[model samples]
Target chain A: MEHRIESGADALYMDERDHVATALRDMKAGETVQYRNAEGLRAVTVVDDIPFGHKVAVVAVEEGADVRKYGEVIGRAVVSITVGQHVHVHNIEGIRGRGDLGSKEAAAQ
Target chain B: MMNGTFMGYQRANGDIGIRNHLLIIPTVICSNQVCNRIMQMVPGGVAIPHQHGCSQIGADKDRTFDVLAGTGKNPNVGAVIIISLGCEVVDPAALAEEIRKTGKPVEFFDIQSVGGSVKAISHGAELAKRMMADLEKQEKVPVPWNKLKVGVKCGGSDATSGLSSNPALGAAADSLIAEGGSIVIGETTEIIGAEHLLAERCVTPEVSNQLYHIVNRFEDEVQRMGADMRGGNPSPGNIAGGLSTIEEKSLGCISKCGKAPIQGVIEYAENIPDHGLYFMDSPGNDIECVSGMAAGGAHIVCFTTGRGTPTGAAVIPVIKITGNKMTFRNMEDNMDVDVSDMLDGTGSLEQAGDRIWQEIKEVAEGKWTKAEVLGHQEFSINRIGPSL
Candidate 1:
């Protein structure tokens, strides 16, 4: 599987199924960025400045829904995430195989 | 079979070593000072001084013995000089006997038997100097890539780790495995959130069970210690480097193993089996993981770091890779390969992998890694149980 962007795309979607695309370079607010996925090439307008190597949600994710990257569920979004928004620790929670998530789950409820 | 070969020292047991080193081992923490002194006195001598060896019980004591013996037994080590504190739980004679199985020269002495610290250092240094001279005269012979066993590891990870360097390293690992070589991936703690992915790749049901067993066992130990792995993992540096979750970090961590079927699961510091890929139950801590791989008989280790680390081993060489352009530029002295081009769209992952594969060959041909050139011989053995 190839992972390089020959078309000068500013972001990368690891798989067509991945809901989040990682920023290959920093993008200013309102900048339109191109990303390639399994489906085809697509564009998203950055609502927030995305730094290098950080994830930007390519698809809108509802609160408590899984945030998929590399075609796998990395975590669940803590708040409703819109497309082009910066996705990081502030808005997502790690829930996979955790032993101490009861308090976090309770807080979410 | 893999094409091309590098100049190496082929051992009597048929294992090929990239380097011929004189190893000095301390059976107890009490012997660490004397071992270090002896190593210093002898040119080209390396010593691994650890803090365990007395009042250790059961598995802990066995682990120490295994690591020390394994280090002495590594193919890179041409000869060994063992130093004991005269009275420690780890038996130097038995340890030397274990290493002698490889048919390498081994010598042992305890402070009590040798009179005192002064006499012990003098005796150990003399033995080490001779061993070093003997190893210096050993000629390098052509050894195929298939004879190589490399441990794949990542530390100080960030988002680019999974996206670039780790996956590029994975490609390189696959290339080696395709040629009948063996690749080892460890760090059970780092694979916490995404172990199921690896478990699914096991070649057999038994191997899958062992994979799950070790992951579960580590989680159980963490729970017993009244701590959760997610709290400390992904580490602070990882988070600062833009990793938000343990799941995110782990998903990236496993990429360094390439896309190989998990052949078997081995205990920490156990001898790595020949051929294909094996998973060792080891910590994600950089030095401890590298040490386990070296003790497991790895000829070389490929280490990926996003934030940068200058860790090397006492015996084998550690090739450092980074996927962060900034980290690479900032820590140019510490890093070797820069796959950051994958992130910048200047290079493909395959090309980056090929770059690393070339580095491995050159290193096997006697090229020094940045850590080796900088003389960073960091070594640490993973310890279990308490010291009494």
Candidate 2:
């Protein structure tokens, strides 16, 4: 569980299992940033200008797929998402405490 | 750091208090004005005025009585003055008797019995002045750090809250527990999505079951009202601050409890047992949560907020912590410590935790927090049922 701090690192990898990384600073579109996860050092280009404290998709997610942050399911994708895309309420839907757990049930489809 | 002690007022009941306050409490809402007037007339008198003393039945009325008694029993309060309207559901004499068990001075008066508001105010003020003077005479002695009970709370949370401040607070919580002190983390609403994580840490299966039961009961209450808990939580401010769901907010919220095995689960405003970490079933509202902790005998409170809030309890000092650098700078007057450096990699989590631990000792040693210095004595009781 080592996270290498490469040059120009702009986001924090909270946990190795987390599929989403948090932007430590406001990142510009197309900017490259280094992140260290359990798999070792890697880089992802920012497709959107992610605001500070916001999440970025470090792994591509399909529509209705669960989104993992802090190694727990924070929500599920409402539509297909790609790596480097900003992940938020616009493209993601919360699964926890949902009145219907519809997304969890929908994930099986 | 683990073996340190702080100067405190050691009460006859064997409880240690960090602050020696003369508390003026109103048994019913109808007596709020009289209590406030008494407080204004007497210097060094603190009053907690709230609604819901009349027309409350069942558990709701019991909660009001419990909170009032528990607050007066808080070790920080050196004495208590009770004001009643003489016809409220909560009897002033009964309330005074409950708090008297703590061996602290207790006095009571009724507006109706006293003849009118002016007479009641005058009578209450004179009693408060005498009590304040008497409390000031109490001497402070050295008390072990482990004897201290502190409440951990987070309000107006943001993305940075869980990431930096809350974990830092958790570390401090662990430190306190390791030294044999007690730390109680509350806000059942905030733990909606994170209950499983806490349940996994309970010392016994029964404790875990209690944890789940409280969370489920709260959810059921929300459902009974024909509303969704998610819609009200992660409030608009939380969303703007980058919290998208209750799970996300909860993941951050639970970090403040640290890694201690939960010793037990207690009802809101219940007496907080000494030692270890406990969970109090309470609301997410800042004032109400802090109020319950105070009533539960918390000598001090460590409140972490990312968006910043100026909330302090009537009987205890609240030390505010924030992880958002922007918020810390903008609300410097309200914030006590800033761990924003952890976000930019300028500081480590352990350092942030140590910083909070240091602030706790300083406050316990009679140092005033930003809220205390600003005179933010906010107090509000959480209600369970509607008024009849």
Candidate 3:
């Protein structure tokens, strides 16, 4: 997917499949930020303050659903996330390299 | 724009060196002081004082010896002086002999043989002075890009790392490979979740299997400890910078190597091939990883970071590039290049990549990186087992 540069974009999404866009600057709650994705320039009014270098959901995600970034699964959503809400450890859980989960799977097997 | 050729020192073993270093190696931790003393006495002398070399057995001992010997044999080093503290698991003679095979001058002795630390320091200082004199006389000639081997690495990463600096460095890596040069990517732990992506890019089935093997081995080791890699991996700092999972971090981390097809996988500190892109099995710890690359014969390392790191190697130059503008503005003394403008829609990826490519050429031709100028000679070796 192409990342076309749109002047004055407040955030950037790497691929068309990415569910979240990364904040280019600290954004306030209830603020509308513009970002460029494969679909071109789009706007999202954030429900939560997003810090610079942090991720903000560009599309809504249901709990336990895979979150894609760079056109790959980054993690699974731990809670239902709304569009424009902050997306990070608070709302998502990493599924790989979880030795805590590996032992549990071993016991179940 | 500068030409494609870089002015570099021609080594006796047909290797090209960007820096002609007079390297002083301490064969054992016990000899660190003497080695450091000699470094102080002899101008232009660089010493690597590491913790291993004593009470290590089997592969562990061999790894320490290999890393030390490899660092000495690095083309960047013009000559070497090895100091040992009489009795250590690492044999000083064998270490010197290994480096001598490179056709470079090597001198070695033990503190016991030279009376003590004071006498050894004096003797080592004398030897280093003479070697430094000879190294100063070597001339640098025009060398093509194919003669260089560059290592791409990322540490203290944040969200912007994958988006900007890392991929930009990847472009630079690809540019070097296009010139028939070599690029080595490591930090096997960081690539755990993203190994499958890299595997698909391997040139052969065997190379892909090796990639998976290393990833599986690391995961099994982590599982053996019954501990999660979360807190340790998407490190507290990484989390603070918005990297939530190892998968996300790994995906971002691998982008620094560009899109080159993987040619082969080599053990840590093993000699990197003369050309093509290779992967070295190594740890994610900043100093240990960079040290391994240096030992593997990397002439220079291009390190990308979101949170700034002041890591450098004993004999090789580390070019620090950052994607976080604040981190760059705050740590300007430690940072060499800033590509954060790409995140702000102010700079294109090609411009960022070209900026790094220009920096690589400049550093290759004798320009000092901020790490080198600030004297950040950080080095560490990855161990397989406990010290005996």
Candidate 4:
């Protein structure tokens, strides 16, 4: 994926396939932030107040669908997420190293 | 620009050391007070007082013994004085013998045979003063970059760690590797979902399989206890800093090692080879991981943190780099490098990488890291088995 190092962007999205953009600063609800991705620069209006260094969804995600970051799957969406919503543990759950799920779904498998 | 060389003390066994430290080691918990007292009485003396030395069996005892011997053998230490209680499971004589193989001055005695802590402290102090005087006579010679071995680690991570500091440190790691220096990356428990990426980068199938084996071993142990790594992996601070999953954290964590192909996978506290990149199997606990790296012979450590930590090692310098502007500003005394500008668009990734690389070069050439200046000589050993 193309990575351009330009100035003055509000959020940063690492890959073109990523559904979320990390807020570079504390962002309030309804504020549109610009970011650069493989497809070129784009803007998204945040629906939730996202804190600095937090993730904000750039596209709508269906529950149980994989969420991508750094061009790889980071976790699975636990709940349907709308564009510009804060994407974090509240909405996403990790699928690896879940020994609490019992031996059937142990991390080794 | 400075030349790619640093002034280093040349040891008797031909190993180059950046620091000429007089180390005092306690063979058992019973001798800790005496060692500490001796360290206090003598100038330029460092003491390591640990909890393990007795009641450990088999592999556990072996690990403790290896770490103690390895620490004493580190090129950073010029002379070693080992104090034992004489009743501990760990053998002080053997430990001193292993260190003496380096051809450095090694002295060992028992508090029991020396007639208790008071006399032991006085005797140890006298030996340490004499050793320190001799170490002062040693002169540093010009050493090439290839003589350096650095350990890359990340802790108290935040989302910014992945976005900035980690990748920046990765660039520094790559630069060091390009210069024929060595880099070792550990924290097997943190590399859960990202093991495949690292495994694919292994130089051979054997190394790749070993990477998978270590990951599976950690997972099996977690499964045996019916405990989920999630309950502790991202940790409360990590979650508050916006890291949601171990997969995300691991991806960022691995980036600190750069893109060097894995040469081999070694056990925790095992001696790191003289050159290239190696992966050591170690836990994610900050102190234990750093200590393991020190025992493995890392001359220095480049640590990236977003939430910030003041952790340092007893035998190595830990250079702290952070990706959060606020964190760096708030903890400037502890942080050595700030690469947070990558997030705000004020700096490019390459520029941030260069910044870290420059810091590493300077630190290698006798510059003190913030952790060292603050006297944070934290040490801990990773245990594999229960104490008997």
The local lDDT score (0 to 100) that residue B115 gets in candidate 1 is: 89
Q: What is the C-alpha lDDT profile of model 4 across B273-326, one tens digit per residue?
A: 977899999999999999999999899999999999998889889999999999
Write down the DockQ of candidate 3: 0.58
Cα-lDDT of candidate 4: 0.89
lDDT of 3 by residue, B212-330 (tens): 99988888788787776888998999999989888899999998998989999999999999878999999999999989999999999999999888888999999999989999999
Count clashes in each candidate, considering only residues at least 3 apart in sequence or on different chains.
1, 0, 0, 0
Worst 10 residues of 2 chain B by lDDT: B222-231
Better of 2 and 4 by TM-score: 4
The sequence of per-residue lDDT tens digits that candidate 1 reaches over residues B274-301 is: 8899999998888999999999999899
What's the distance in Å from true for residue B59, model 1?
0.5
- Candidate 1 fnat reads 0.41
Model 1 regions more than 4 Å off: A1-3, A102-109, B2-4
Query: For model 2, what is the error of residue B60's alpha carbon versus the real structure, in angstroms, after optimal superposition?
Result: 0.7
Return the interface RMSD of model 3.
2.2
Tell me the DockQ of each model, to 2 decimals. Answer: 0.44, 0.37, 0.58, 0.60
Off by over 4 Å in 2: A1-8, A39-41, A100-109, B1-4
User: Rank order by DockQ, top first?
Assistant: 4, 3, 1, 2
What ordering of candidates by lDDT runs from best to worst?
3, 4, 1, 2
User: For model 2, which pairs clash?
Assistant: none
